[model samples]
Target: MLQSLVPLLVDGLANAALIFFVAVGLTLVFSVLRILNVAHGSFYSIGAYAAASIGLWIVSSGFSPYLTFPALLLSAALVAALFGPLVERTLVRWTYGKSEAVQILVTFGLFLILEDLQRMVFGVQSLYEDTPMALLGITEIGGIVYLNYQLLLIGLAAVVIIGLRLLIRHTRHGKFLAAVVADREVSQTLGIDTNRVFIMAFALGVFLAALGGALATPTSGVAPGLGAETVVLAFAVAAIGGLGQIEGAAIAAVIVGLARVLAIYYAPALDAVAPYLVMLVVLLIRPYGLFGSVTTRRI
Candidate 1:
């Protein structure tokens, strides 16, 4: 039992870290931008592809191996810098203040376009480069070999949670974002440039989603339809924690992670439905969400 337990917890946290990144980004977007962004998953796959490509280049070119860490960050930055502003300015901006149906449709359309663009650029086969993982190596735990890279992921997730909290709570952009979240029209009336805020929020959302993808590249394969699978899990996390609650997303991620782990260990049939099952129960009780509340929807 002890042998099984260690690997299970390790696996759960590893899975949780990636989903946490994507889910938190989704929640943040909803909190500030108020968009469902069904296509948000595309950014994830793009980030993963970017990371794998960059990591592979570094190794193939004989660059210093330590660069892989920076490569992870750069992959996300590159995706965010390129696609973030472009998508926001062109398509996402058009959906602002639109109905939920329109927002979903536009973003989903963008998702399809971006997904195809990735295939055109990278082709359909999977890509992965684990220089980072190779550097860290492995650990022995409970008769099982655990990758140190996995633990690194958990640390990364914690840093992101704290970093995001500070970004939203301590910084100027955070205050502006908070104001937007509080009341968009009022913030605009108060001389806050809502358009720019929207751009920033959308870009940040892209950054987080892409960062998640980039981080996963070292351990996971990047391929077509990857975004689709990841998006469903992220949506489950986002919904379970409450659409706009950051802390809630984190806690819910852990719970969902553990639930999945337990399902795989004891009741394999529940593995797929575990997270959503928890979501269903929580929403049934709270309606709004565990962290969500029925409040004014004015934007």
Candidate 2:
């Protein structure tokens, strides 16, 4: 029983790690910008594509294989830097005070444009870059062999959570973000440049999403329509965790991940809908989400 459970637990955590990264990023951006970005998942696919392309190039050029690990991070940073500020300044900023429907429509248009751009550049073929996974070797856990890279993912996710908590509690930028989140008008009145904050927060969100994609490239294929699929799952996660709640996102990711793993093991047909099922159940129980609370507006 222990042996049987170990593999399930490990797989669940591994799944949760990837989901958490993207979910947290989505929630973070929503918390700060109050905008639900439909195009966020495009950044994830772009990162995966970038990492795979760069890793492939490194191998072809006879560079040190160890460089592939760093390439993953570099890919995410580059995507965030390239698109984050540009999108925020041009498209996102315009929708600040607009209705949510307008925001969704505009971002959906952006998503469509990005999807086409990805197809044009990467073609329809799937890309795989797994040097990092290959280099890491394998380990035996509960009589089952597992990739060391999977364990590394679990560790990295934990690190990101802790780092975010520390940043929010101890850093100046984090304080600024908190203040803005608490009261945008007051923050602006206190001389905080909310525009700059918006850009930084959006970029950070892109980085997290891209990082999730880059990391997953070692274990999964990067293909056309991947962004759409991911965003749907991400939205389910965001809803289950409660939008704009980081801790909620983490817990929700874990719950969704476990649900998925269980479905894969016990009911293959339900694997695809596992996360959404979890979301539905959670929303039924607590409409505000696990960590979300309804806020009353001051008249």
Candidate 3:
């Protein structure tokens, strides 16, 4: 029993770790900006492409293979820095005070644009870079061999959860974000620069999404349509957890991850739909999500 379960648990947690980054970032942006960014997954793909490209370049250029580890983080940061403020200020800000339809339409259009951009820039071929994974090697647990990089991802996810909690509960910027989430108008009235907050929040969201992609690049292939697939999973996660709940997102990611793994193990044909199935059941029961509730919105 332990032998059979160990692989399942390890794979599930590893899957959840990547999903958590994207889901939490999506939830965070929605919590702050009150907008669901359909284009958020584009950043993820871009980051993967960047990381793989950078890692490949480093190896080809006679650089140490270990540099690939830092390259993952650097790729995420670069993607966020380049596109975060740009998208938030121009496209996202325009959708503010607008209808949900308008927001969705605008973001979807942005998603299309980014998708095309990715195809044009990165081409349609799948890219793979696994230097970091190779460097870390593997570990044996429960009589099973598992990639150490996978375990590292699980640890990283836990650290992110704790780090985010601390950031929100103990940091000054977190206070501002909390205030804004509580009452945007009141936050502005209290002299908080809501615009700045929005920019930072969006950028952070991009960073998280990109980081997920970058980390996953070592274990998976980066292809043109990866963003579309990831965004759907992200939306399922966000919905299952409640759109704006951070803790909800974390829990939802685990559920979705486990669902996917289980499906792969037991019913390979249902692998793709497992997460959505869980989302459907959860939504049918809770409607507002596990961690979400009915609250009055202030215009």
lDDT per residue (tens digit) for residues 40-111 in model 3: 898889999999999999999999999999999999999999999999999899999898999999999999
lDDT for model 3 comes to 0.94
Clashing pairs in 2: none
Off by over 4 Å in 1: 1-3, 141-144
Clashes of 2: 0
Better of 1 and 2 by TM-score: 2
What lDDT does the true structure give each of the candidates? 0.90, 0.93, 0.94
Best by lDDT: 3
How displaced is residue 155 in candidate 2, in Å? 0.6
- On residues 132-190, what C-alpha lDDT tens digit does candidate 2 reach at each position? 99999999755699889989999999999999888888999999999999999999999
Go through the candidates in order and give the C-alpha RMSD of each one to the true structure: 1.6, 1.0, 0.9
lDDT of 3 at 179: 93
Residue 164 in candidate 3, Cα distance off native in Å: 1.0
State the weakest 10-residue window (summed lDDT) of model 3. Answer: 138-147
